[model samples]
Target: MNSTQQWQNVTWFEVDEHQDGQRIDNFLFSRLKGVPKSRIYRLIREGQVRVNKKRIKAETKLAIGDQIRVAPIRYEIKEETDAPVSDKVAQSLLSRIVYEDEGLMVVNKPSGIAVHGGSCVAYGLIEGLRAASGKKYLELIHRIDRDTSGLVMISKKRSTLKLLQDLLREHKIKKTYVAVVKGQVSLDKQLINAPLLRYELANGERRVCVSKDGKESKTQWNVQERFMHGTLVHASPLSGRTHQIRVHGLSIGHPLIGDDKYGHETTYKGPKPRRLCLHAMRLEIPGYAPIEAPMPEDMQSLVAQLRAQKADKVVVSDKDDE
Candidate 1:
C-alpha cells in the first residue's frame, strides 16, 4: 500500500480477518499515512470512498472479504516537522502506569492532559506513550475528559481492544469516579436516572443536557465524606454517556466543584480549586482484580481543607451554645 502522497491511481483493498470490524475512518487513518483526518472524512462524505461498490458512512464497519475503494486525491505535501517527545514528558507518562501486560495497560492519567491527540492538541498521552515505548499497536480503549484525571485503559492488541469494547457496550465493565460537588449532600446513596441529549452550540462547543428526547443515562452516587459547603462522593456511571456524572450532578443541584462548564458560582468561598474535581478512582472488570488510582494531591489537599473548615464550624457552633 502506497502512502497518501505517493498515490496517483485509485486503490482497492480487501478486508482480511485482521482488518474486519474496524471502522472505515479508522481504517483510512491507518492506511493513508500523512493524510489529515478531516480530508479523509470529507472524502467519505463526498462519496469518494466506497465499500462493496456502495457509499458508506465513516463509522461503517468492515467485514471479512469486503472490498474498499479509495479514490485518488491530491494534497499539498508539507514538511514533517512534528517535534519529538521530550524525555521529561516521556518519563512522566511512564511513571503513571499502574498496570501493564502484553494485552493492555492501565494508566493513572493526570489532569489537564488529553488521552489522545486531536484538534489543537499536538500530542497526547497515547501519542507520547507510543513514542516512548515504541509500541505501534497501542490504542485507547476508552476516553476520559482532558480536565478529569484517572484510570485510562490502553489496548496493545486489536483483539483485546475489541473484547474490552464489547464488555463496555454490554455494561459488564464497571467504572467508579470520585468527585467533590459544590453543595453538601444529605443522602447516603442516590440513583440519578435521567435522559441526556448531546448537542453543539453555534460556536461549535459541545454540551450535554437532560431532556426527554435523549438517551437513558444513570449514575449511582454515594456520599463518601461531608463538608459544610461541599460533598465528596463516589459516582458509578451505569451508562457511558458523555459527561454522565457531571450532567447528573448538575441535575441534582450539586455540580462538581471547579466545573466551569456545568457548575455555577457558589457562595462558599474557602478555597478555590485548580481543576475539575473529578477523578476515575476505580475500574472493575470481570476476570481481573479491581484497578485503582489514588486520589491526586490537589484533590486530597482540597478535601482536607474542607474537612478542617467543617471542624472549625462545629467548634464555633458548640461555643455559641455554651
Candidate 2:
C-alpha cells in the first residue's frame, strides 16, 4: 500500500491485520499527510470519507478486510517534509528506557517532551525512539501530558497494544503519580469523583473542566506529606480522561503546585517550582511486577524546600515570648 499517496482522486484502503482496530480518522491522518484535522473531520462528516461505502464517524474502528474510500481532495504536497530526528533527542529518549520486552517497552519520559508529534512539535519521544531504534510498530499504549514527567508504555507489536489498551480501559492497570498540590489537604485519603468535559477556547487551545454533563471521572489521592503551604500526595486516577487529575485537584481547591493551567499560581508564596509537580512514579500491571520512576531532581528540590519551611515554622512557634 502506498500510504503516502496524495488523495488527488478517490482512494481505497483494505484494512489488514496490522491496521485492524485503528480509528478511521487516525488512519486517514497517516495516509492523507498535510491535511488539517478540521478538514479531515469535515470530510468524514460530509460523507466524503466512507467505510464499506457507508458514512462513518471519526471514531469508527476499522476491522480486518474493511474497505475505506476517500473522495478526491487536493492538498499541498510541499507542506509535508521528511525531517530527520535530532541525535540529541533520539539518544535522550533511548537512554530513559526503564523496561523493555519482546512486546513493549517503558520509558521514563522527561518533562517538556511530548509522547508523539503533533501541534507545533516536529517530533516527540515516540518519533525519536522510532528513528533511533528503527522500529516500525512502536505505538503509545497510553499518554501523559507533555509537561508531566512519568513512565510511559510503548508497544512493539499490535497485539500488545490491544492487550495493554484493553487493560487500561478495564482499569486493570494501576498507575500512581506523585504531586505537590497548593493546599494542605485535611483528609489523609480522599476520592474526587467529578465528570470532565473537554472544550476548546476561542483561541483554539484545548482545556478540560469539571462538568456534570461530561464523562465520569475519579481520582484517589492520599496525603504523603504536608507542608506549611502545600501537600505532597499520591494521585491515582480511577478513570482515564483528559486532564483528569489536574481538573479534579482544581475542583477540590488544591490544584497542582506548578500547574500553569487549573492552578492558583498567584496564591502560592513559596519558591516557584520549575515544572509541573506531577510524576508518574509507579505502575502496576496484573501479570507483571510494578514499574516505578524516581522523582526528578527539580521536584525533589521543591519538596526539600517545603520541608525546610515546615521545620522553620515549627521552630518559630515553639519559641518562648520575647
- Strongest candidate by TM-score: 2
- Local distance difference test scores for all models: 0.82, 0.82
Runs of candidate 2 exceeding 4 Å displacement: 1-12, 23-60, 69-82, 264-266, 311-322
Please state the error at residue 103 of candidate 2 in Å: 0.6
| Clash totals for all candidate models | 0, 0
Judge candidate 2 at residue 162 and give its lDDT: 74
Candidate 1 displacement at residue 159 in angstroms: 1.0
The sequence of per-residue lDDT tens digits that candidate 2 reaches over residues 14-110 is 9998777666876776566556555677788799999999999876878899999999896644333454677776787889999999998999999
Model 2: lowest-lDDT 10 consecutive positions: 313-322
lDDT of 1 at 187: 74
